[model samples]
Every structure is written in C-alpha cells, then in structure tokens.
Target chain A: MGELRLMKGNEAIAEAAIRAGCDGYFGYPITPQSEILEYLMAEKPYEKTGMVVLQAESEVASINMVYGGAGAGKMVMTTSSSPGVSLMQEGISYIAGAELPALLVNINRGGPGLGTIQPSQADYWQSTKGGGHGDYHLLVLAPASVQEMSDFVKLGFDLAFKYRNPVIIHSDGAIGQMMEKVVLFDPIPRRTDDEIKKQCPWATVGKTPDRKRSIITSLELDPGKQEQVNLRLQAKYRKMEAEEVRYEEIACDDAEYIFVAFGTSARICQKSIELARAKGYKVGLFRPITLYPFPVNPLRELSTKIKGILVVEMNAGQMIEDVKLAVSCSLKVEHYGRFGGIIPTPEEVTENLISKVIGG
Target chain B: MTEEIIIAGFGGQGVLSMGKILAYSGVMQNKEVSWMPSYGPEMRGGTANVTVIISDERISSPILNAYDTAIILNQQSLDKFESKVKPGGMLIFDPNGITRLPARKDITIYSIAAADEAGKLGILKVFNMIVLGGFLKLKPLVAPEFIHKGLEKSLPARHHKLIPDNEKAIEVGKDLIQPFTPAD
Candidate 1:
C-alpha cells in the first residue's frame, strides 16, 4: 500500500536504510554489493535525513566506524560482499562482544577466498556460526526477494536495538543485482540525541551527573567476569532462538517430501515444488527467513510428516548441516547445491528431489 | 499468464535496458515482474544477458534455465541461448552479426534486421527499441500506452525527448520482423 517502485535488491536496501532513519552507514565498495553504497551516495541521504553515508578506505575501517557510531547510540550499519566482510571479522567480533546494536549486511558472493562475484549462500556457516570468534551469535535475516531486502533494514535495526545485539541481512549477489517490484514503507524520522539518550541509557553519551559513567569494551581481565559475559551472550542467543525463529511453509499440508532452502535458493525451490507437484509428487517448500535461530522446532515437526527433505543451497552444502541438526536425522535429508556462483535451476532442483529423495 | 524471457546481446547493444523496459511495462500493467541481469566483468565488452519474467501470479524464480522467448542480438548470445528456448517457444534475433542462424527446428524463429534498420533511421541507439517493438508485435504482452509509461518511468527525465523517437523505431521494428526460412 506504500510507494511501489522497481528497484534492485541493493538499491532497495540503501533506500530502506535511509527511510528507516538510520543514523549512519559506513561501508566499503565491493562487487555485487557496491550498489548499496553507490545508491546511498547518489541519493545523498545526509541531505534529506541527516544520515551520514561514508565510503571508508576499507571494510575494516568501515566496521570500526560502525563500532564508533553504535557506541554513541546511533542507528548505524555497513554492507559488503564476502571478501570485504572477511576483512571486518575482527571488528564484528569486537562489536558482538561489546554488545553494541549495529546492522550489518553481507550480500554474499561466491567464496572460500575471493571465489567469484556471483551469488552464493556459502556464508551461512560464517554468518550464523560466529565467523569472527567468541561465543557471540548474530541474528541473521536471509531475504529471498528485493522486497524483503528493503523490509529487513528496518527489521534488522529494530531487532538489533531490541536485543542490544548485531543483526545481519544475509543476502546474495543474485538478489542484490536482480530487480523486482517492491512496496517501500513510510519514512521514519531519525531519533534526536535526547531521544537516543533516553532510549539507550547504557550508551556512552558522556558523563552526566544523573547517571553512572558508561564504559564500552569487550575486555575482561578477570576470568570469572569473562565467563559470565559469555554466559549472558549464550542466554541472549537462546532467547532469540526461542522467540525469533521465522520460516515459511508452502503446500506442506500433504507433502511427502520437502525442500528446505533460504534466500535465492528458496525462490528456486518454490518453482521446483510447483514442477514436482505437476508431475504427481507431493512436494513442498520450507524457506527460512531468519537463518539463525534455525527454525528448528517447526522443521522438526514437519519432518515427522514428510518422508524426506532436500536441502538446496548455492553452496556445496553448508545450511544442510543446520538442516540435519534441526531434524535430528529423523528423515532422509539430502543436499543438492551449485558452488562457486552457479545457481541451480528449477528443473535441476526438481530432478534432484526426485532422484535423491523419491526415487533414490 | 506467465512469460519467461531472456534478452541477450553485447553489453552496448542495450540488451539489459530492453529487458528493463519490458519489466517496467509489466509493472505499469500491475503485473508481477522480475529482471535478473548477468553482471560483472563479462558485461564490460562481452555478452550481456538478462532473464525477465512477467506473470499474473507471483513469480517463484527469477533465474531460469529455459525461457518462453529469447530476444537475441549478437551471435555470441545466439550461440549461447538458442538451445535454451523451450520447444515450441519463440526465438527473435537481430541477425546482424550472427554467423550461424538458429538451427532449432522445434521453436519458432524470427529475425529482425534491427541494426540495419537503426542504421537507416540514423539513430543506432534505438536499435533495442526496434527489437522490443518486434517482440510486442508477436506477443503483445503489454499495451502501447503502458510502454510509453514504462519508457517514461525507466528512462531518465533527460531522455524524455527520445521517447517519441524510440516509439517510432518500435513501429518500424513491428514492420521489419519476418519469419526465418532456411534455404534448402
């Protein structure tokens, strides 16, 4: 019902960040995702909403800038591809350890090391399993469409602030570059400094007589305190797992087999389900909108009904591990993927489902 | 109804833009549409292609292996995508730089001398519009008014003056397209 426009996934993310009243965006340009920065620079949100859009020298500097902004209780974010995101791992770990609210977007490209500038979901492990280090977990939202790419900016920031944790919009090159119709939400005004101070009482907003001087750091010299911090982080992750598990089930009411996928792969499996059903196979699609939290309970319940599950991805098989863990190997779970930027087609997915699950 | 199409040609041949226009036109008609382009270094001077899907229902996948129609411009695209068209589908090409014609017997083949036509029109950039015009003639997926609106929406405001010229090229293209017949 809002403004409808045709936009690429990357452009939609940028526009959504601006409209979400994001206070700052510090990012480095990278292939497949440079459009996020390019669009921000072109739109000049600073002129409109007073949002600071900076092009840092590298991903490391950009993420550090995010740390600075987040510590000050500013709604801040940064986006990058796989290689660029790899450069920011240390910074990300520090932010997570510090419990700062920041939004990070990884428009994932093919990877192991600068693999390709094409779409891939290989970063599933790196994103959800704490790519940086420590016992921290980032709330990862995997958007399958350009529309969700726009919607998740606001949602990511909201969840980031809600849990005082970092949130990631884990997308891919295909969704980044692909154009689709999206209905944008109405613009929300950026919070004033006083509003931020009131909202984030723990933020390092300067020493005031009314409150204790806030210190922001991930370091704990004493082993006892560090263990407590790790325990607190684990508790928060468990809370997220219980409260924020988001997934979509299509035609699963009577399906004998299911395809579990996220992001671009989920969109492909939707079509594969249609094709499989046309050929008299009772197949369904289960798409995880939130990669973390894993959507384990619903999937486990569905596993009891379905005979098997085909875990499809753009990687050689990363999320498959999580899928297996979710179902506890109760049903035959198989993985079919195309790594290094190759996207599997609908026909290929359908054929794999038939051979790997039904016929095999 | 759903139409999955692939438009491929050299980077400068307006292959991506043509697909954008088609997608925008679909949007103008309040239809679900997606345009997924092949990006990166290969788009600089090499073959560039875009997969476009317009459907009355929600489109499931933007990346497809085969298409209902293929609008090809250069020979490289013809070589790569000729076999990717569905059997009994349609293949439309410029046939300007193509060395080997599409040899598929199952699909309908049509050639539009858009490059030569654009040369005669004294505006080479409108070559893609001519090809688009040829496509609309056969399929008529979108109406002319929506296309005018699509051109307005997709093209920058500075290029508004060129819409009439592009429309003229589309009209020229509608006339220039012909069914391909192989010589025995």
Candidate 2:
C-alpha cells in the first residue's frame, strides 16, 4: 500500500513506467492511448526521476529512438495504438533480432487498417505471432486490470532484461481508457551509468578498455552467421515457452466449461462465469496473462476436465487459433466475439456459452 | 454492495468528471471501483456516457449492458438509457431540455432541475454537482467527508477553493430533487 489512487489504465502505465526507473519513453500519440504520453508529459518525470520523455515525429521515429536508447543499455519503452504499432513492426523485428531489452505497449484499437478508435484485441496474431517479416516473437503480457496495467510495467522490464528480448504489453482501448483504483508501488531509483555498464556487458556503452567493443545491429550478410543467429533466437524463444507461461483459473476446479480470454474480454468472461453459474451451468474462466508464451500446458490439462472452451475476444477470432493448438483440437473450441470495436456484454457471453458451447 | 451506475450527458456537462469524483470517492472508502467511458469522436460535442461500477469485491467488467442507477442529463441520454436501468433500480435526471420523460414503471425515477438551479445560482459549472447531491440524497453510497476528499483528489489543487461552492450546489440539488410518478 504505497499510494492508492484512481487512474485510467494508460495513466497507470505511465506512472508505473516512471516508478519502474524506466530511462526513456519515446512515443507518438494515438487515440485511446494518447493518455500514456499525455500523462507522462504532464508529470514531467524528466524533472522528477531524470527520465527522458520525448514525443517523436512518428511511430517509426519513436521505435527507432527506443532502439537507440535500448542499445545504449538504457531502460526504454514506447506505446502506440494498432496503426502506429504497424509502423513499428520493422523496428520491433530489428530490436528482437539485435537481442535488445526493450518494452513496447500496444493499446490496440479496432483495426485491419485505421479501424475505429475503440478497444479491440485484434492484434493477437500480430503481437504473439510474428508481425514483422522475421523468425521472432515478442514476449507479450496481457493485463486484465488497471492494477496489472501498473504492475506489469516492472514485470515487463524485468522479463525483457532477463531474456534480452523485447516485450510487449498487449492492451486495448477499454483497458487503456477505463479508470480503476490502483495501489502504486514505491519508486525504484534509476540505475546509474556504471550500474548499467555492469549489468549489460553486451550493450553499446562505448569501447571499454576491459572488453571488446559491442556492436548492436541485426544485419548479418553471411548466410551461415544469419542461420546461427536464427537458431540462437529460436532457442531463447523455446526457453521462454518452457518457463514463462502465465494464466489464472477462476472456479476452474469444478467447471464443466471454460471461457478462454485475455485482457478486457477476460474481465467480461468473469462476469459471465458468475451469470452462467447462477443458472445452474458450471462454467469458469481461464485468463492468459502472457499471450506469447501462452498457458498452453495448463489449458491442455484443464481441457481434460472441461467439456469445451469458448475463446472470447474483442477481435473476430485471432487468439482462438492458439487455443485450438493448445488443446490439440481434442474438444470443441468455439469463438464468441464482437469485432469492429464492439464489446460483447456478459449476458451475450453467457448466452453464447449456453447456445454455442453447451447446446451447439 | 455492488452499484453499477451510468452517467450520460452532452460532452461539456461534466458527465465524465462526475463519474470520476464518484469513483475516486469509492477509492477513498476502500472500495473497488471502475469508470469506463464511451470515448473517441462521440465525446467531442456529441453524447458522452460513462459506466461506473463501485463494489466491495473485485469488479469484473467495466463495460456493462445495464446499470443499477442512471444519471441522465439530456433528452437523448434519457431516451437511450432509461430502459437500460435494471428493474427496481434508480433513474436520476436533470429535466432542463426534455420533451419526453421517463415512462418506466419498474424503476424508481427522480428528476432534479440542476441545470436551472445552477443557472439561477449563477454557477452553471456546478450543475453536475447538484445532480450528484440529488443522487447522494437518494442513496448515500459515499460519505460527505469522503466526497470532500474525492474532490480534493480528483480536481487539481488550483481548483480546491471551489469545493465549498460545489458542495453548496450539491445541497441545492438535494433539496430540488422530486420523486416522479409517470403520467399515464
């Protein structure tokens, strides 16, 4: 109980970033998520914690700025909506390929192109799967509450540095714009330059007399060397898959049906679980906290106990593919969603559970 | 107790800020709270609405289809949200520019001339506060002291001097609200 305050998810993320001792935040404003940059600017963490907050000319410039700062062994991050995130795909791939520890937040809005400015989880395929042209994956975290929106900033940074890989906090407009009560953590002091040099020996912190000069780039013209780079990246992703799967099971012990969802959809499904249970239907919710290294094993285990899974999302059905693969297509796995920025109600989810999963 | 509330009005009517103050009050009282607004282009001169849920338990969905209470300011909001209130719920509104009034027989209805009252008081900005006062009169979810704390926390410190004025408007609202019986 450090400090209790009512905050929007975007505001909470900005506060948490500053409290996490983040070194820099470079972002271009976008609807539903412009609050992140707005809040940061208003707070002026540059004066408070000596953090650097810059409004880049565009999303491409923001991502490149993030790359530059991260390469210098500074804790750096950027936030954008779906369209802006699309502009940063190549940069994200470059960061991933360079093994730079950076954090990215995608407060997704409805999108195939420049979709509506309302909440949508339509970026599941683009975020968890490789959005850019590369053999890579961003460790994606899906925060279901404003509390997690605050908490995951530190967690994302920790995970990013642990694996030396970029991490994405896959959020949506609903979570980004909605307000909730949150207890903030105490501020962790920003790391000193010497501390960063000691922590990130691979960082481009200028030529040191004690060690070889570190070059930070994704380019490897030689085919054999590029293959080795791909192999190393693949092994790191596998290691993440083995250890980093995170999820939550609510009333799952006795459930006959499970609702698989993340972020805002998971919040709705929790209410649906209560509604369905009152009607004598045994249902539960399985929320994946980490979307990239999805909670595949636990869901596979839960699949043996449940009758079916309704993969609810704000998207048409992006995450359902992963849900299908997780369970090996052993049971009925259906998708219930409201795309184009429409959020399905809890009653609709309960109705879908009754008609689609149980009856259908 | 879980109270799901919707506050709807035109963009400049302070609908979102009223909900924010209420949610902040809940936070002051150690309750779980969430405020989800219908944002984007609709918030610019168009109808704006926010769904606020204050509960003792962890709130599940910030987005909701129905609410236990609806605070409607305009005719458009009343037409849209009057039916969305749960049966035996509460509907509070400011009847300043309304042709068609609420006809719901299941839920209890109350009308407060907050806009008119604020205009008469020569403080039109406190119109939402008047409505909030009316709401507290019906269902005192948060204490007055906590509301003071809420305003202090939600509003910028530069605006702290106006807390008493807002509180006075709330009192005016508490007196002005009248229980409505539909004219069949």
Instruction: Compute DockQ for each candidate against the true complex.
Output: 0.94, 0.90
Positional deviation of residue B140's Cα in model 2 after best superposition, in angstroms: 0.7
Tens-digit per-residue lDDT, B1-184, candidate 1: 9999999999888989999999999999999999999999979998899999999999999999989999998888888999999999999988787888888888999999999989987989898999999999999999999999999999999999999998998999999999996544
Worst 10 residues of 1 chain B by lDDT: B175-184
What would the TM-scores of all predictions be? Answer: 0.99, 0.99
In the predicted model 1, the residue pairs found to clash are none
Model 1 lDDT per residue over A242-296, tens place: 9999999989999999999999999999899889999999999999999998999
Error of 1 at A163 (Å): 0.4
User: Candidate 2 local accuracy as lDDT?
Assistant: 0.94
- Screening candidate 2 with a backbone cut-off below 3 angstroms (N, C-alpha, C), the clashing residue pairs are none
Chain A only, candidate 1, TM-score: 0.99
lDDT of 2 by residue, B46-77 (tens): 99999999999989888898899999999999
